[model samples]
Target: MTKFFLLLSAAAIAAPAHSQTSPDSDAPEVVVTATRAAQPLSEIGQAVTVIDRAEIERRQTTVLSDLLATTPGVTVTRNGTVGALTSVRIRGAEADQTLVVIDGVRVNDPSSTGGGFNFGNLLSSSVERIEVLRGPNSVPWGSQAIGGVVNIITAAPTEGVQARANAEYGYADSVFASAGVSGKSGPVSGSLTGGYLRTDGISSATSGTERDGYRQYGATGRVGVEFAPGIGLDLRGYFADSRVAIDGFPAPDYVFADTPEYSKTREAYGYAGLHANLADGRFNNRVAFTIADINRDNYDPSFGNDPSFIGRGRSERYEYQGDFRPLDQVRVVAGVEREDSRFNDGFTFADTGITSVYGQLIVKPLDVLTITGGVRNDDHDDFGSHTTFGANAALALRTGTTVRASYGEGFKAPTLYQLFSDYGNRDLDPETARNFDIGVEQAFLGNRARVGVTYFNRRTRNQIDFRDCSPSELTTPGSICANRPFGVYDNVARAEADGVEFTLALRPVDALTLTANYSYIDTENRSVGDDFGNDLARRPKQTASVNADYRFAFGLSVGGTVTVVGDSFDDVGNTTRLDGYALAGVRAELPICERFAVYGRVDNLTDTRYETIAGYGNYGRAAYGGVRLRLK
Candidate 1:
């Protein structure tokens, strides 16, 4: 690693001095909300990755899991096809350690015991791009950002009236269709998008017949108006509904005659915001409000005596943010947000609420050096208050290389279900972590090729986990051990994780582009007990991926990618292990004319049946072909 850094430093110094400058006379820049300010990406002293729309379409990726799998230091597990639950891990951290944001609004539910966002029901067709920031982001974002933050930015209206429709059919008798329209008129602009997807699912061993699988429908609408020269108003709304059949675990002795179960879920989210310029346009400000509602119903006839588990949750949030450029090179940002959440479950559980306030500053002392700092305070109705802070600095040497380092602290408050659920324990405390990272980035081949490498380390204390307890110690005083309920939430563990990641992107030629990413992690969990420390579950020791895209003459383009994941543990006991696997995919696009095009994709071309989630099976080879129509 030291050698790599030295080489990068040397290259950074030489490239700028020898290269010819562009007419723009400015460095390429990307705007991000990493600091709660629209600052350039190059100035942020952290690991950040951006996925644009063109790449999304090129890969024919239809879900968050698909996109995350390609990002550096990130891993995703998919249970099956549409509507199946999906989870993500960053930098060897657990799912709950990552924070998810949609258009600047937090999507994680405070009532969920899992403490993570569920992407099973999210509609990806409306997403324009995604920004992924790795490392502790809790100081700028809130709790649950110990590992990182992922922000999904939706698309806005275009300049002229435009419309498009797409449809695809694939293996397992799956089908999908979507249509969208967007345009600008005078000072008003609007966009509307909708889609439907369905599949019959592959055969399951537990069920003699193929499972019912899933079907989903969703719609999104947005409208924005420029009320004044430097002012705007925007309103956005979205709804999604899905029906999924659940194939429960195999019966004792691994019988395969059980009928498939089923469930239904509905979700709706909406937001409205106003933006304005202040201090003669030197400061930009935004005030926004959002609401989200979710309902889920499950039906399992096999559990004859058990009552159905039904849940309904609702959340509302309000935010006010301001960005001020006090000087040419100094920017200050501050924000305050409040969230109120309520849940009604068939079982007994009380309503819960959480609120937070945050502030940040970014300063550039020299053209090549930038510094950032931020802090946040959060108050939970049940856990009182906790604070987190972060600091980072970046230096760009005269050579074409940049170096950055950062340190931060994060905390995750106990959830309502963890404290007050039917099987919950109230003695559990919040989890906390302190993390640090350092990295370097270098450009070569006339800026057409870029290489980046980073090293990250994190130490977490008072981690929450389940512990076996005797029946007599329970509040209800039942035979808990006899019932085989071996776990209860408690703070009993400390964990440490360190990892190195490398990424390379090269446009070898104008018509071809290639990219590669690799990561290696070392993780350990220390629990005061007879058991020795072990590697954390579901965190692969090594992972790598490579992709290439080529454009042929006559408006034809093709792309391919291959991914490899190393071995990992399945559970805390470390008794179960998931084997490594590799998979490949290819896609092609042909434009028949300016107004129409056709595309096709083949995934898991090798028909690899690998378990991303231990004990759970993944889908086999699948293929999809589609056509798109454009109108202007």
Candidate 2:
């Protein structure tokens, strides 16, 4: 890690030294996730990052998590290889506190112990855009927005029939393919996509020999119809069936290998929406219904023959949203949401319901200043009601500098598994966070270069964790064992995280773009005694990334990415530490024709041996190449 940082410093000293500028006339279009409404990137007061379609295709990523791991202020922790339990944390927050949204629906699994969205099976084939809004944004987004929001937006229908296909083959006998089509006729538009992926991955445990394999088949479809100039109806559906090998306790040789334990998971989601604008486009409304279902069956071929059904979970959501511009300089957005979650194990079934109402106002009293404020109230069937608030401000000075600041309160309800599982505790309270951030950005050299620095702080309370309360301490009324009995979840953990983020973007030439970002995070576990004042798990003190790309003539391009991560602990008490490392990759694309192209990438150029988890396997030097075809 030290050598890596030294190299990074040398590169910075030798380069033009800046980053990709915030969206401007020379940049991309407006983004909708930052404000819950379409707005330019520079007009928002929050730290939001957007990875668009072009960038996605340029990278030719296999999974959604890979792309997120390269961004600033985010961390991806995996148990072992692909298809394993992968968790994404933003700025030292727990996995469950970060919300994942596909289109307009929150997709956290209620059956999971933490009620967090798993990043294992999310493919990048059908996604057109991904916007990561950092910090607590609980006003527009509801519960579980304590850390931030990852909005995966899919491809919208385009005019005329357009088709695209992709195929890739790489090391470890990995294979990937995807085909998709989209079209629009008059007022009707639709899109359909399908993909398949398989990989023979390495062992879960470092000492294991046998390989673990994974495969996934998925499809997505969407249709839209416009009844008027600014009115539309839309329907969408997505499904993925994945088979993955997993690990449990170690064997006699202390290796978690030679096990025939695997799981097959089928996840499905459906959504329907009615969106329209009325009264000369001043009032806009959207009514949507979403359904998310997950079914899993665990199997141990060593004991039986075929995979057996293990568990099933489902979530249904309904929402009504409205945006109105009462005055030229004032806008208001409000929404009402209700969600139902259920889980069944073929015996004991549990369910819960949550309802919420939220509203926000945006006022632009001065052309150079913007103000935003919002409030939200949520009622959980199991717990009582809770309220949240958020506010933001942005001011643009005439000297080509912008100042921004924001503060928000966030909360997350307990999951069904946490309330009804074997270690369930019915007295748990909702987790909460108080978040604040401030920053200033300045553009130079005809807006071709930009540099910014931001400081953020978040405090979390009422965190839940399981504990054995038997030895000379508190005990439950029920009895199962004489000496060791009580084990239940409790809200006894609190956390504090503060960080500074620096960004630089510069387009020194017409065909070359350079960007760099660095984050310094200091965290303390202010929990109820145990592990108190300790640094959080899997959160490194510093993370930095640099991206450089130059497009040449004749439809040829080359790009490279480098990331450096600092050392950090891997457990609650900081007993286990995972050494940090550096990763480097280069990519190139060659256009075969007007509608055909071949692209390849080499990852882990240094093959630096490192692990994110103590006993997990790490990916080494690997290479992959593929072709793309477009028909219109």
Candidate 3:
């Protein structure tokens, strides 16, 4: 890690030293995840990545997690094929520490072991845009932002009537189809999209022979009505039902292998809100209600006809937000919210609630500078109250350069599963962290080339981890694990992560675009145990990706992508090693008419053998083709 940083410093010092001016004329991009309100990307100090619908179509990626893995400071690990257990880690933080929001509603599962959102079931077909904040910002987002935030925004109303559809088929007898429509007829505007996917996948275990399969049906919709010039009502909803074959250890062998086991999951999220613009749109206020419901079931045909396990989780939230701009240079955003969570495991039920109030102040002290500060207070039913604060600043110069710095604090309350599951420990405490980062960006060559680099550091305490029950404790009277022979959850871990991210984009010509990024993260386990000072499990220290796309004069486009990942330990003890690997793919599209087009892509061109999770199978060389139709 030290050598890597030294090389990075050397490269920075060797770069050309020259004065440049801002020449770009394109409109500035707008993002909402950083501040929970629409703000120009250049005015925010936090690191953020935006992937739009055009980019999604260009990549030809059906699974959202696959695309997210290529971004800087992000890592994804899957147990098996599509629809299997998948986890996303940001900057070496645990999966559950990252908050996921879909269409303004939190979608994390309260019944899961870690209460994290599963990215495996998320398809990119209905998504219109995604905003990823790369560091802790709990002050505005509330709890579970210890790592970062992933905000997914779906399709919205369009100006005129429009419709689009796509269908694709590929390896493993896979099939995918989707359609969407959006328009505004009178005072009402609405959009709806639906999709389906099915694939005969490979075995979950590396050495297994039997093939597993997966199927999913999903949909999203939004409707809005403008009653008057300053008042409106909006509604949104999302739904998905999926099933995937899984492998388990049979009694005879008690080893990881293929088995007649599978799991089914259903997720539904909904939101309704009323908004009013007062004082000539300077004071905007909104009141909203949201809910997330999830159900999961696992079955083992070899054992019985009924499901062997069942789990359910739900979240209901009431929120009110108001943002006022009393002066042209000053803006204040404030919000109050209450959330209730419930979980059931077919045997016992548990619930919890939290109330939070937060506010932020945005000040443009000068024409070239902007500063933001925020604070939040949350009171949990079991954990009492906690407060957090965050602040950031951005400085832009006419020389086409920008400098940013930020300090943030975050926390994550214990989930119902951790506090009430079979191995639960009611004494578990919430996780907390402190984060800091600074970065600079520069654009040159008539705004055709751009480069940026950032450095971040974070420290976390009271991290909850699974602890094995000792023989003596299991048999002792009145012990914490007196009757629990397996294990228990406890807040007995600490961690620290520091990393550097570098990004580059070049549009050397009118028809070609090239982009690349690299990240180096150094993570350590600070707990007092044998794994002390060791690297975190399943987190790569280095990751890099490069992509290039070109369009011809006759409506033909071609592109390719390459991703490289470095190796790291699979466990905290560092007893198992996972090797590094590379992936490469190519794609092309050609228009057949004004409203129709054909496209194809070949993934895993080299068929590299690799694994993100130990003992899990990974896909190989595969090919796919599709057709698209659009009408306006």
Candidate 2 lDDT over residue span 377-419, tens digit each: 9988998799999998888777779999999888888888778
Instruction: List the lowest-lDDT window of 10 residues for candidate 1.
Output: 16-25
Tell me how many clashing residue pairs each candidate has: 5, 5, 0
- Whole-model lDDT for model 1 versus the true structure? 0.76
Model 2 residue 144 lDDT score: 90
Off by over 4 Å in 1: 1-29, 203-209, 250-258, 301-307, 471-487
Q: Against the unseen true structure, what C-alpha lDDT does each candidate score?
A: 0.76, 0.83, 0.89
The regions of model 2 sitting more than 4 angstroms off are 5-29, 250-255, 306-309, 472-486
Report lDDT (Cα) of residue 153, candidate 1: 77
Instruction: Please report, as a residue range, the 10-residue window in candidate 3 with the lowest summed lDDT.
Output: 14-23
Write down the TM-score of every candidate: 0.91, 0.95, 0.95
Residues 1-632 of candidate 3: C-alpha lDDT, one tens digit per residue: 34333333332232211111112337788899988988888889999888888778888879999989988899999988888988999999999999999999999998888899999999987999988898899998998999999999999999999999999999999999999999997889999999999999889899898888999999999999999888999999999999999998989889999999999999999999999999998999999999999999999999898999998999999999999999988999999999999999898799999999999999999978989999999999988899999999999887889999999998999999888889888877789999999999998888888899999999999999999989999999977788898999889999999999998877767677767789999999999989899999999999987676777899888877777889988889988899888787778889999999999998887788899989999899999999999999
Root-mean-square deviation of every model: 5.8, 2.6, 4.4
